[model samples]
Target: MASITLKTPSLSYDIHIAAGLLRTLYPRLKKLYPAKKSFRPIIVTSENIWALWSKDVLASFPEPPTVLFHPVGEKHKRLAAVEKLADQMVEAGADRDTLLLALGGGVVGDLTGFLAAIYMRGIPYVQLPTTLLAQVDSSLGGKTGVNLATGKNLIGSFHHPLAVFADTNVLATLPPEELRAGLHESIKAGIIYDPKLFKYMQANAEAILAADPAALTKVVAASVKVKAEVVGLDEKENGLRMILNFGHTLGHAIEAATQYKQLLHGEAVAWGSIAAVQLAVSRDALSEEDANKIVNTIMTYGPLPQFRADAKRLVTLTAGDKKRRSGRRAFVLPKAIGTVEVVYDVTDAELLSAANSMLTLMKAQA
Candidate 1:
C-alpha cells in the first residue's frame, strides 16, 4: 500500500493506493466518519462500473448505499448532469450531512465532487476512482467540474475530497484503450515535474503496458506525489499549478474540435503534448534530440488514436479555453523532458503552426 498526504489551503487528505483496497472501504469510512456522526453515504457511479465491482463495495458496507448512476462520456459532463444528480439526492432527503462517494472514473468523480460542492452549499465527499486516469490525476487534485460546449472543465470548483481510495485491483477490468488513455496523464506528470518518473516509465514501458501490479502501483504513487506537491503549493491553479496543464491547453481544444466524441481526454492530450513539443522546438526552447525523445516516448505509449480537425479550427477553439486569464491565452510548453514553462504570450500563428505539425504527425503515424 502506498499512502500520500496532500495538504491544501482548506484541509489535508490522504490518498490511499493499493490493490484490494475496495474490500476494506467500510472500515476506512468508519475511521473518517465515526458512528457518532450520522451521515448518509451515497454512491455516485455508472451502471457499467457498478456491475463489475458493486458486490465487493456493497459487502464492505453494513447496508446498501443509495446509488445514483451518471452516464460515462465527456459530452455528458455538464451542469445539467450535476443538477439531475442533486435532484436525486434531494428526493432521497439528503442534506449537508450527506457523504458522496464518487465511485467510478473521472466523469463520476468530477460530477460527484461538483455535486458535493454545490449541494446544500457544499458537503463532503470521497473519491473511489476506478480508472487509471482518475487514480493518478483527476482523483488527487481537488479539481471538480463538468465541461461546457466551449471547452472542458469550464464550470467547476475547488472542492477537496475527504479522502481518496484508489484500488489498483479495479484496473484489471479496464479496456485496453482506456488503460492506454490513462497512461498519458502519467506521462504528463513525468514531463512536467518528475524526471525520475519519466525514466521509470520509459524503462518499464513494457511492464506498465502489461498492467503489472508493481509497475502500475509505482506509477500511481509517483504521479499522485507530483500532483500533490503541485496542488499543495497552488491550490487554485494560481501560479505553479498552471504547469500541470502542460499538454492540456491545446488538448482541450482538440476535445472541443471533435465535440468530445472521437478521442479520449488522455489521447487528445497525448497529441497536444506532441504539438507543445513542436512549439518548444520552434521557439528553440528544446533541442531536437530531446524533442525527438519526448515525442517518441509519447508515441511509445502507442499509436495514439487519430482525429480529423482543421489546424485553424483547433487553434480557434483554444480561444475559448478556460485557462485564459484576463482574455489572454495561457499555454504550458516544455523546455525539456522534465521541465515546462507557462506562457501567456503564445500567438495564434505559433499555435496554428504547432497544430499543423501535430496533425501532420498524427496522420503520418496513422
Candidate 2:
C-alpha cells in the first residue's frame, strides 16, 4: 500500500492506495469518525457502480447505509442532480452529522462532496473513488462541485475529504477508454513536476496500458505525491497550485463546448495538453522536439473518441474558466518536460490558433 498525506489550511487527510483497501474502509472510518458521534453513513454512487461494488462496500459496514444512486455520466453532473441528492438526504433526515461516502468516480465524488459541503452548512465526507481519473486527480483535491450549463465546475466549493480510499482493485473493471482517460491526469502530473515519473510512463507504456498492478501502483503513488505537495503549498489555487491546471484551462473549455457529452474529461485534457504544448512552442517557451514528445506520449494511449465543436466556440468558452482574472485567463504552459509556468499574456488569437491546430490534428488522426 502507498499512502500520501495532503495538508491544507482548511483540512488535512491521508489518501491510501492499495488493492483491496475497500475491505479496510469500515475500520478506517471507525478510527477517523469514532463511535462517540451519532453519524450516519450515506453512500453516494452511480447505478452502474452500485450494481458492481455496492455488495463489497455494504459488507464493510455494521448496518446498511443510506445508498443514493444517480445515473452515470458527465451530463448528469449539474445543479439539478445536486438538488435531487439534497432532497433525498433531507428525506432521510440527514444533518451535519451525516457522513457522506462518495463511492464512484469523479462525478459521484464531486456531487457527493458538494452535497456534504452545503448540507447543514457542512458535513464530513470520505472519498471512495473507483475510477482511474478520480483516483489520480479529482478524488484528492477537495474540489467538489457540479457543472452549470455555462461551464464546467463553475459552481463548486473546496471541501476536503476526511480520508480518501483509492482501491486499485476496482480499476481492473474499468473500460479501456476510461483507463486511458485517467492516464491523462497522471501524464499532466509528470509534465508539471516529476520528470522521472514522466519517463516511467514513457518506458512502461505497454505495461501501464496492460494495467499491470506494479506499474499502475507506482504511477498512482507518484501522481498523488506530486498533487499532495502542490496542494500542501497552496490549498486554494492562489499561486503555486495553478500550475496543476496545466491542461485544464482549455480542457475545461473543451468539455463545456462539447456539453460534457461528447468527450471524457481526460480525453478533453489530452487534446488540451496538446494545444498547450503547441502554444508554448509558438511562444518559444518549449522546444518543438519536447512538444512532439509530449504529444506522442498522449497519443500512445489515445485515438480519443471523435467529437466536433467550433474553434470559435472553444475560445469563447475559455471566458468561463475559473482561472480567468480581471480581463485575462491563466494558461499553464510547459517550459520543459518537468516544468510549467502559469501566464496570462496569451492572446485570444493565440488560443484560436492552438484550438484550430488541435482540431486539425484530431481530424488527421481520426
Candidate 3:
C-alpha cells in the first residue's frame, strides 16, 4: 500500500492508494470512528457503482450501511440533488454523528462532501473514490461543491474528508472512457508539479490504460503526492494552490458551454489544457517544444471525445469562473512542464486566440 498524508491549516488526512482496499475497509473505519463512537456509516453513491461493488463494501461492515443513491452526471450535481440527499438522510434518522461515505466518482464525492459540510453544522465523511478522477484529484483536495446553471462548482465548500480510500480494484470495472477521463487529471498533476510523474505516464501509458495494478498504483500515488504538497502549502487557494487549476478555468467553461452533457469532466479539461498551453506559447511563458510535448502527452491518453463550441463563446463563459479574485480572472499558465504561474492579467484577445488554437487542434483530432 502507498500512503500519503496531507496536512492543511485546519486538519490533516491520509490518502491510501492500493488494490483490494474495499475488501478490507471495515477495520480501517473501526480505527477511525471506533465501535464505541456509535457513529452511523451512511454511503452516498450512484446506483451504478453500488450495483457493482456494494458486496465488497458491505462485507467490510459488520452492520449493513444505509445507502443513499445519487444519480450520476454533471447535470445531477446541483443544490436540489443535495437537498434531496439531505432529505433521505433525515428519513434515515441521521444526525451529527452520521459519517458519509462517498462511494463513487467525482459527482458522488463532491455531493457527499458538500452534504457533510452543511449537515448539522458539518459531519465527517470519508472518500471511497472508485473512479480514477475522484481517486487522484477530487477525493483528496477537500474541495466539495455542486454546479450552478452558470458554471461548475459555483456552490461548494472546502470540507475535507476524514480519510480517502482510493481502492484501485474498483477501477477495473470503470468504463474505458471514464478511465481515460480520470487519467487526464493525473496528467494535470504532472503538468503542475512532478515532471517524473509526467514522464512515467508518457513511458507507461499502455500499462496504465490496461489497468495494470502496479502502474495504476504508482500513477495514483504520485498524483496524490503532488496534490498533497500543494494543499499542505496553501489549503485555501490563496496562492500556490491556484496552480492546481492549470486547465480548469477554461475547462469549467467548456463544461458549462456544452450544458455538461457531451463530454466527461476530464475530457473537457484535456481540451482546456491544450488551450492553456496554447496561450502560454503565445505569451512566450512556455516554449513551443515544451508546449507540444504537454499537448502530445494529453493526447497520448486517448482521442479526447470531440465537442462543438464557438471559440468566442468558450472565452465568454470563462468570465463566470468562480476562481476569479478581486474581479480579475486568475489564470494558471504553465511556465514549463512541472511548473506554473497564476496570472490575473490574461486579456480577452489572448483567451480568444487560445480558444481558437484549441479548437483547431480538436478539429484536427476529429
RMSD (CA, Å), candidate 2 to true, equals 1.0
- For candidate 2, give the lDDT: 0.91
> What tens digits encode model 2's per-residue C-alpha lDDT throughout 240-293?
999989888888888888888888999999999999999999899999888988
In candidate 2, stretches whose alpha carbon ends up further than 4 angstroms from where it belongs are none
Look at candidate 2 and give me any clashing residue pairs. none
| Candidate 1 residue-wise lDDT, 1-366, digit = tens | 899999987789999999888888988987887668787899999999999999889878988989999998989999999989989999998988889999999888998999999899899999999999999999877889998888899899989999999999999999988898899999999999998999999888999999999999999999999999999999999899999898888899999999999998899999999999999999999999888888888899977988889999999999889889999999998888889999989999999999999989988987
Candidate 3 structure quality by residue, lDDT tens digits, 229-305:
99999998899999989899999999999999999999999989999999999989999988989999999898898
Provide the TM-score for each candidate, comma-separated: 0.99, 0.98, 0.98
**Candidate 1 TM-score over all chains jointly:** 0.99
Error of 2 at 53 (Å): 0.6
Task: Give candidate 1's whole-model lDDT.
Answer: 0.91
List ranges where model 3 is wrong by over 4 Å: none
Candidate 1 colliding pairs: none
CA lDDT of 54 in candidate 1?
92
TM-score of 3: 0.98
Per-model clash counts, in order, read: 0, 0, 0
> Which 10 successive residues of model 1 have the least lDDT summed?
30-39
